[model samples]
Target: MASETDAPVDGVLIGEEATPIDLTEQAEVADASFAQVSQVQTVINHIHGDIGGASFGISGSRTKSRRTSGPVSGHEMAEARTRYERHESYEAAAQQLGRCNMVALIGTAGTGRRTAALNLLHDFVGGRREVVVELSPAYTLEKLATREYRKAHGYLLCDWPKDDVDGSIADFHLREIRRRVRDAGAYLVITATATSLPAGDQILWQPPPARDVLLAYQVAPEIAAEAAAHITPEHAMADVVALARDLAAGAPLDQALGRLESAGRRDVVAWFDAPRSRGELFEMAAMAFTAGLPEASFESLLARLESIAGIGMEKADAVSADDPMPSRRLLRVAEGSLFSLSPGRRLEFKVASHRTHVMRELYQRHGMRLWEPVIEWLHECAALRDNPSAQAEVARGVAILASVSDYSYVDSTFLTPWARGNGVMRSQATAAMAVSWLCLDETTRSEVLRTVSSWTRASAARPKFTATLAWSGELGIRFPLEAVRMLWLQIRNSEKPVRHAEIALARLFAALTEATGNALPMLDWVARQISNDKRIGRAIDPLIRAILSVLSARADGVGIPTVTAHLRTRPDSAVPLAKLWSAVLVKRPHRRDALAALYDAVCAFDERDDDDRDHVRALFAALVEALPAKERPLLAHDLRRYAISRNTDENRLEILLSLLRVFLSPAVLSLDTIGKHP
Candidate 1:
């Protein structure tokens, strides 16, 4: 190994008469002032360019003896001197090192400990022509005992002795080296990370505060302070140094920023979006944009921030309003008492590109616990005067509510006024309100139903509403049965068709059927309205198709209660129920319960003496015959059994005729024990 000296022995002028010792060119001695290697130390297997080199399976022989060495000449000592003067912390450490007999400069990498050690050595010599011999734990004891081993002023040891090296061996070498230095009346200065070295008169050379680092790179004090405010003290200096070097080399901005974090801190750094914690800044800015700056008051704003952050005021002081070093993400206005968007600053939080990402992080992590506070703040905003911007702010709040699925704001008091407005804000607000309705808790949903019910009665101007029923159907929210009945009456009484009303009616039918597990109420109501007024039925045929489409997608059978209720109450329900059964059967023929219910309804002919029963039975027979061949036998058996059990001949004959007509289908060729019809 090369000796830790700046030049060869002949270079130094030690008072002109005495020749300086060539510590580098000395014989490999078995005796010296420091311990030397005597036994085989531990070995490690290493990959030599296994990535780009071949592997060395075992590195046992490679653990050879190495002498610990130190800087011997002042050739490049000027560079070390300049770094010492640049930062106050380094200068302080150098001064402290001058007074200690054995000083260890300890810190993490990039903390500048070695520079301080070399500078401290410079102070120790007082410009004398002396050299520092660095000792290694690997030196053999016999080599240390050799007579030719006496050296100059002091010894230097830096990060040495690999961690897995035996502890007793390392301690023996360190003790021998200290004895050699003390016996020679010489100095010993060791520089290492905190993890490796023994406790001593240690001078911790932390990276300078960010300000000094920025100043070193020629950053203006104010700008540097602003940047410094964004990062922790431990990180600020390293980031500044990396940034300055990259900027000096004209590296790209991202590349420069990427170097700010070392590998060990990558995960912690990822939590910060811009080398700083800007999440709180963006959230407060979002609140300010609508609430009016400083008008909200600092204490009140801090409380809101604290609430969202879910921390007490004292614990949240770093990002608090009282933080002396506030982020440039927001600017202090009015002599720092109030805050607002900085003039000419072009607030990045407002940019559409990053806005959603910032908002998502805020709501998903921080604002999750602030739901009640956010709702109250929104209520305040909603009370603002109905200007376009105020309305737009309220609309934005509605959108935020939708994004987080916070649906407590679906009340008529919050929604009705904005729903009636004109323009883009109104449109967005209307859609957002519908989404909120669909996402509301069951209790809130029930409240919304009552509100809509009241609104329909109280509203005479034919209030405009969207296909909210459709949205509810999509979200699986049960549409209110009362709203469906009320909307059906409007359809029946209207002289002309209302498009939105029809869409709403269709969605309500699907939602109610999904909720009640049957289409009976919806079908009964529609059939009753149609039989009472055929004009309305013709007007609502499109709605019927839409509802049927929704039901067909949901392949589950209609409930038995639904069939029994409709069959007992309205004979008119048979044909419509039969049609629904056909629609469901066509989609899912394997739904045996639907087919059985359809058959049961057709046979419940005794409950209805009207002529509609024949049409219903005929429709049922046609649907039954249309089933795939595999499904025909079981359905025919069910029908024949019902027919035989009929209480009267007229009922039995009506059913038999329907059954016989069904058997005539080309697909149904078999005859059961009752008789062969063909």
Candidate 2:
């Protein structure tokens, strides 16, 4: 045994005793090629396909097994692909490694050097030499590095220090054979790429070993011609050179090369036969190669071939929902089939929660489609949320279903009845469902306007109060003249003050009048209710004051005179003082001609009442003595209209009319003298 520090020179005639590192390091050693960790990762990626059944278990003991697949013959699908080698400039430095001493690949790593070394090993060290020993960085301790060389010799053959591993391979978790190889002084390797290795026992990649090992896998000329002639479909030729290169990788020989050539394959020659991006680039080539393999070939030749970066085969399930609406439709339209690769992933809407992670793994490792199968599931899951029973995402679900701002159509046609309708779900389910529809999107607002027109035409004879509120507040309409018209009518027709009337008033006045306009009905209702419910009459005063304020604002020499003549016939039933103060007193601030008439009427009524036993009889006498014969009919009509409008008796009307006739027929008497007549 000898240390690299004290090694004897060899090329030591072909079969002479090679230096044994095991004695120096007190560890068992074996033989293996030297390569870097990145190269190892590249090869491992290809071999890792269809591997779910091979789960890692708590291992005290285990048996080894190997699987193989056939290869496409060089003649069958060949191409005269130019063989290329990684430049020594890009190579990571190599060194003797392990306590037992094996050829160790060492370097302050550049780029493709490690992987270039791994690729060479794939061609030369075709058998068990394929296995790689991945070592964890924590095993820097000498005691840990050589711990498992003897146990691992049968299964593993190379050692790659995650970060400068030496000494005990065991401490670094080296595969047994890798440990032995390092201890045996013949295997050297590097491990610095992947955070973890799937299987350590496989040839990953390396620089060409012996010339025999570096055999260029070229196709026959005709095959290359044929393959080259067979151009990829024009539409599939996005990044055309990439496709041509893939075609070359798949064709058996130059026989196909002519075909590829005839197909104008050289048009995309830039992507042919070179290693650029290890993960995706390699996977695409592998997939294409695997697809083109001949049925008759032995799979053993292709077994443990390097993996396309992070790819594999798995069982795809029937579509699962991501949302509630049109889930099936979305699935129907996808171009590719769902492929299950990783577990606990697309298990749900389980989309790539992190784009950096998914995108990096995919692009960095070869366009990994880990979320594709589940991506559609995401689309479908999005649809199902609309089905209130499936999930509780009402806002999202409704957003999906709505073609407009209002869901009134859904309510009228489907949802509202469904809320009260018999079904597996109700209450919250119904609420969610209704809410789903209730929520309006940009388009739904237009739909609401259209529906309102239809509603209006249908309700031409009826009122449209409900529809109005539905449009305004609920739908976020700021200016709706149509809505306002409906509100104004509802207030006038209502039996008493309704709660929505205030909401209607506030919204309408704010919109149309800038908070200045109000209907007279509110003032009338408040006054009547207050006077009737005397206990809270004082509470009504402020509102009355506000009404007065608005009325005065409306009275500035306007056309058609907003002042009502309707109250003139039935003044007792009207708020005369309120109206007068609001209109004339507040606005004019000066004497009014109309005030003299009111004062004269008041004086006449007082003089006639005198406490006479026949109060009505004396008032009639006073009224008749004061009037002229020509006005009798007009006075009678006024009294009649007043009583009827107030819903009072005809008897009161007759008494006033009769008193007016006392001074009729040119027999009028003085007002003071007429009091004795009763």
Maximum-lDDT candidate: 1
Evaluate candidate 1 by giving its C-alpha RMSD to the native, one decimal: 35.9
Give the least accurate 10-residue stretch of model 2, judged by summed lDDT: 26-35
- lDDT digits (tens) for residues 7-78 of candidate 1: 123223567654533322322210110001000000111111121111111101111111113234454455
Stretches > 4 Å off in candidate 2: 1-186, 194-215, 221-678
How far off is residue 308 in model 1, in Å? 20
Give lDDT per model, in order.
Answer: 0.42, 0.30
Q: lDDT score of model 1?
A: 0.42
